[model samples]
Target: MDVSDILAAQAEKHKAIAVEKEIPLDVDAGFLAVTDPNPIEKESYDENVEEYLQSTARDGVQVLLSALFSLPTTSSPDGPLAQLPPPTTTLPRAKPLPKPKPPTKWEKFARAKGIQKTRKDKKEWDEEKQEWVNRWGWKGKNKEEETQWLSEVPANADVDYDPTKKARDERKARVAKNERQHLQNLARAQASGAERKQRKADIDRTLATTRVSTASMGKYDKKLDGEKKLREVKRKFEPTEVSADVEKKNNLALLAKIGNVPAKRSKHEGNDAAINVRKAVRFASKGEGGVALARRAEGKAARGKAGRRK
Candidate 1:
């Protein structure tokens, strides 16, 4: 029997995978993005939602895999690895671009005069040392005159005048000037109407504090012109000749306010009995109170004597 028909059937069964759609799938291997632009068939989707979705996803994945395999690959120990090209798709930035900083006075001046800023080399060539030495910092060329064995002094300079000290002082002055200018620029940049008003208020408050910080608390100090009168805090007290009834009420209110005094409940309050239980108890104990009655019932009359002996 001929097996050509069976072989042909088997060949048709196991063929290369191919997915066809109205629109092609856009695959960005660089970003690992696979977008399916083809519209879903309503009849197929309505028949089975889950299967339709899975089929659409499978087709997209198959297209992405095919695109990936088509790319050139480099051989490695493990296997061949394909290098993805730069992505063509332009994605939006997650965060907005940062705002430019406010220009400093020097920067503004440079821009105005069309002066291009240039960076100076940190290292400089030394003729004597025959090597590149730092222009500044850590035994730099700027400090060479101060550290040198011999230094030339001015002809008219005093006998006590030191050339090394002079050079060091000049360098320090330049550093101090630069720092002062930096602070000035910062202050200028940060200055505003609101800031000026706040600064003025701060100055006034400081001045007021200083005025009261004198030996006599500014009482004996001579007042300056245009100085506002400081507000004096006066303490008021109740009259010594207050009515007895009013004073008693005031004392009771103060005691209540401090939680020192408890409310006096009515005789029937919290007691369902017709007779006042408290009064009956007091009468039965002969004004000695419940403590005396309890001691008498417990037969502890000799408690005081025992306690005293102990």
Candidate 2:
């Protein structure tokens, strides 16, 4: 064959082979198409809710009526209508219930923020000593024992010295004694307020000039020095009787608001149902009874038959 004719024949053979290997896809069944134009009507939620409520009410009423009528009452020969004993009534509570405990962990967290129960259960207050004393444990016995290791050991005091050195040492001792005496006088003497201020200023200036440093790296901080005893003493004491007086007034007001309130049966929202009882009873008459109700009704029918035979 010619080259063009051969190429056309090869192409036809490849097309037949491709047809044999072709895969049929079910794309419409697998996924939503990009252009779906069908509109859906929204369901009415109010109608659904009403239907649900109606169904629930109808079912409950059916159950209740079935329970009431199917329960066997003891028949007396004296009367056809047997009177059921009334349910016992409960007495009204004189006092309200105690408040429930806190529900949230936040309340517990707040109470535990910095406070813990006092750890003074085993300790007692010694009013005479103005201190708390540990009562449950034996105290340590502190006996006075003199340590005598250095009693027989003598220090070297007699070194041969020059008279000039002795005189210099005596003069130095006298100067120190005079300086201590002057400081003691300054402490003991009562000074005017202005003099005290001047002395404090002089001391500060001297300390600044000398560049004196303290052993500790601590600085004066008011925050570190919390609520001290000085502040507690400064606070004025108010009598707590005013709170009791206010509580009494509140009690009186509450009593006045609730004047002559007669006791009544507890009111419930379900009692305000407007459904037809006749329809519910009709539905219930068609419905099957529970095992207990069926047995009770059978027993009642059997009893009636025996009484009729007698």
Candidate 3:
């Protein structure tokens, strides 16, 4: 039976059982068919689809025209709607606002004193003291304490360098280098415009790469990323086909095709097969160039041997 007929039969069966049991439905879900009191009028019918498409096309065209017409003209510098400025009046360009300086204690005091600009710190020769005096920072405890701090240690004295002195110095140098690098990285991150984006991308690429281990430099770890995988030592397959097996006159041509050629120096030197291979070479001058020349020489040598034997 068709799906609708089957569904109707099932519904009738369910209705008959319900009536026999005198079953009363509790909710709308119990009913097979749902009734819509007032559904939204959707333009989904076959007859309305064409009209909907035409209406949409008209709306899209209007929107496109409105967008095109809304664009600002090159001739006008005014705000939206391309309004002109007052006649003969110059419009002053708005300058960029300067970054506000941080409020330091000295700067705050100077500002309180109504000073617009502060003098830069500089060393000057003091005429009264007959020495150069610093214009900024503490001079320290009356020069003698400073002299003691700056003085070199007496070599012959009981004082000696600590065991950790060298290590401390190295660590300090490393920290300084790291701090400078950190500053450079911070500058790149804080920078404005396209260069910052490129710098960030480069940083991300570096970070995405596998971290190399300090131990063995990945020499021991076979499974490490970016490390070369282990491969089995391959067997050497040479052209070892016998000349008698092929119809071709040239053994070298057979060797080229089959790739079964044997090495000249083999462990089985005293074997009968090796002896036969050596004997075969005397007649192998079958086809071209170097092989033909060598074969011709061998043939001549063999004929000479035959004449000597007689």
Best by lDDT: 1
| Superior by TM-score: candidate 1 or candidate 3 | 1
lDDT of 3 at 180: 85
lDDT of 3 by residue, 135-172 (tens): 53455222323334244545764556542454446656
- For residues 113-140, could you state the per-residue lDDT of candidate 2 as single tens digits? 9555455466666675577666634431
Tell me the tens digit of each residue's lDDT in model 1 across 59-130. 888888888899999999999999998997899999999976668889999999999989999999999999
Candidate 3 lDDT: 0.53
Name every residue pair that clashes in candidate 2. Answer: none
Model 1 pairs in collision: none
RMSD of 3: 30.3
Higher lDDT: candidate 2 or 3? Answer: 3
| Residue 171 accuracy (lDDT) in model 1 | 96
**Which candidate gets the maximum TM-score versus the true structure?**
1
For candidate 2, the TM-score is 0.15
**What shift in Å separates residue 85 of candidate 2 from its native position after superposition?**
99
Alpha-carbon error at 86 in model 3, in Å?
A: 38
Note the Cα lDDT for every prediction shown.
Answer: 0.86, 0.50, 0.53
TM-scores of all predicted structures: 0.51, 0.15, 0.16
Q: What is the lDDT of residue 18 in candidate 2?
A: 35
